[model samples]
Target: MSLSSFKREFARHYNDTPANYIKTKRLEKAAELLLISDERIKDIAFNCGYNDLANFTKSFRERYSCTPSDFRER
Candidate 1:
């Protein structure tokens, strides 16, 4: 089967596309890490599969309505 077929089956099984699911899960993990540790935001972004700090910050803000540092501060 092709990658598209797998993606379709994955969506049918999980009710979310793989890309969205991955992004959601990564942010969730980042949130958890922020709450549980004293790691820097850049490190957390790297751990969450985000290599670019700016992109990670933008994505995090979009998902959580706050930057990683702000979320950690709360």
Candidate 2:
């Protein structure tokens, strides 16, 4: 199958583009780590595949309405 065909099928099955799916998974994992561990927010962001803490925090806030550290504190 062509790349387009595969991507379309994936979207139809998952209701999300691959990039969105990946970002969602990464954020979910980061939230899980925050609840389960005492690791620093930046470290958790890095472990969740983010290289820059600001971008990670931005994305986290967009998804959850709070920064990673604030999310963890609550």
Candidate 3:
């Protein structure tokens, strides 16, 4: 399926907008990087399409309720 059609179908089934779906994927990738890589926070932020560490941190905290450092510690 085309990306637009897939997005529509996904939203119809899961009630998630394309932006949210993309964000969810990015967050999942971020979690993997946190667990598996020794990359810096700035590198992770840029890789995940976040230009600013503060913005990344804010979104990460909002979704997970913990700082990235804290999340990594656990």
Residue 57 deviation, candidate 1, in Å? Answer: 0.7
Clashes of 2: 0
Report the lDDT tens digits of candidate 1 across residue range 1-74: 99999999999999999999999999999999999999888899999999999999999999999998999999
Query: For model 3, what is the error of residue 11's alpha carbon versus the real structure, in angstroms, after optimal superposition?
Result: 1.8
Q: Write the per-residue lDDT of candidate 2 for residues 1-74, one digit (tens) a residue.
A: 99999889999999999899999999999999999999998899999999999999999999999888888898
lDDT of 1 at 23: 96
User: Residue 50 in candidate 2 has what lDDT?
Assistant: 99
Models sorted by lDDT, best on top: 1, 2, 3
Ranking by TM-score: 2, 1, 3
The parts of candidate 3 lying over 4 Å away from their true place are: 1-10
Clashing residue pairs in candidate 1 are none
Q: Each prediction's TM-score against the native?
A: 0.92, 0.95, 0.82
Global lDDT of each candidate: 0.95, 0.94, 0.87
Top candidate, metric TM-score: 2
